[model samples]
Target: MTPTLNGPPAPPADTRCDRIDRLRAALNRALRGKPGVVEYVLAGLLARGHLLLEDLPGLGKTTLAKAVAAAVGGTFARVQCTPDLLPGDITGFSVFNQKTREFEFQPGPVFAEVLLADEVNRTTPRTQSALLEAMAERQATVDNVRHPLAPTFFVIATQNPVEHHGTYPLPEAQLDRFALKLSVGYPDRADELDLLAGAIGDVSDARAGAPVLAPGDLADLQGRVARVAVQPNVRAYLVDLGRATRAHAGVTLGLSPRGLLIWQRVAQAWAFLKGRPFVTPDDVQEVARPVLGVRLGLAPDAARFVLDQILAGVPVPV
Candidate 1:
């Protein structure tokens, strides 16, 4: 359950959305020319789901993650995952304390409000599995004891798609945990030139002047996202779409029941971002690609085509 904020009550719903819009603008500034990427990332964040960024190197993946952490005014940590990294390193381990005459639990980077797992696929499977519980349960079990993570423990993991030389591909179960996976493709010529200018100059902090929403307030916004109504007809449309994926010839494995819930949450967030109180079919279609494409097993190009077919085949409920 999402913990309630103890301070003054959260601002009204409109105020909260306004605050979110400010953060979105800041992210757009930080990641120039990728408004769609920024929107998807924001949706994942509001849905309280972990994100997987699969893109080439130096595409501002880390920069986007940092900008999010900064905009939210949350603590951020980046783990440069490697083959030798141990589960203990990500989740931390108990150390013998001579003064206390007992083992003392030392927390790891996973305790932060926002964690960036860079080149996550490069790490061993064992180390990769360390995040499963944390991502799913918002808590980590170490030394056979349960340790609760922060209420807003969001993860932004990045992996390189161009390289397969030394990487452990994430299993389906692990991939399912990510709410959405996206690529920050090369910018357009105009955006590229503007980026070059920013490169030569001292780029200002993206969130420096922006109004920073308190952590608790952001949590309240997420709660509001959860409450975003999904009309019955739209809900049925989601189920039909899921069934279509299962029947697709190219798909060896289809989205699971859990995937449907994640899809709804993401759609709800999208609707909320669009200033809507209820989810619409358009919202679902807008988010279908990133939400479903990540979980499909087809080739990257094929996945896009299949998604388009799935959407086109499904009757849009009025």
Candidate 2:
């Protein structure tokens, strides 16, 4: 059974002053044995940006989103992206009333605290725009009506890279909006063995992933994340790192200013998760792949090359 969040059984092991550890426990419990994945996901959330997970089918992408949503204690919604989907299908339209002479705003699936957009690329570009708007701005403007989103609105959108028959590659602008993109690759031999042997009952339900922390807790966490210090040299190093992606001859597009901002936030979040108040070269090195790798790659090995170039040329910003 899921533990109730309304009242505490006792004082926390440590989060009375800081809640990152508590939040991590909640995610790790649901994501069991994938703490790195948990860190990457939380980094995006800490940065207050969206995430994209591209991998083969059945890597538990939906479950990951749901689990993370539960850990943060937010309302989660999943949208199965299909070819026939419409804008109204996602951002809900206002239908005119002849008698009343006014239209009412009908919210679609985008108004939740967390949204899992499954098979995101399967839908046409038009349909994808609805999500892109929410992912980028944290609000959806339909018929010139702007609807504010939840303070903790987060999107975990995924696509199957192996299958391209009906898929649409997310455009560069759209890809730029995601703070980070990751792959939930096939689980290691151990996790897979546990996965195969584990019963369905082992999976935690939405309510099971219930809020261990409240919205204010998240606000406090992000505030603490922002304060997780990055040294001047490290800031220079991060800039040089992102600049290198754009300057790479093979890269058609470079990481944007927005990407630079989000990645800096990501680096700080990463450091904070490790229980460090100050960021180090290791923090930058540890997160470069997940935060900037996929978003700035050229070809199959493009992203890896970008990281290599930065590491070799930048000398860790110290």
Output the number of the TM-score-best candidate. 1
What tens-digit string does per-residue lDDT give for candidate 2 at 1-318?
122232223222332244676777777766667788878998889878788898888767887888777777788888999999998888888988889999988888899888988988999999988887788778899999899888778989898878889788887778878888888676678876776566567574432366778767776677667766666777788888778877877676777888788888888777767766667888877877777755675554767876777668776654
Q: All candidates: CA RMSD in angstroms?
A: 4.6, 6.7
**lDDT scores of the candidates, listed in order:** 0.87, 0.76
TM-score of 1: 0.92
lDDT of 1: 0.87
- Weakest 10 consecutive residues of candidate 1 by summed lDDT: 1-10
Candidate 1: tens digits of C-alpha lDDT, residues 1-318: 222232223224583356887888889988989998999999999999989999999888888988888888888898999999999899989999999899999999999999999999999999999999999999999999999999888999999988999999998888899999999999899998997776676666442334368758779889888877787889999999999999999899987889999999999899888876678899999998889877886777999999999999999999
Best candidate, lDDT = 1
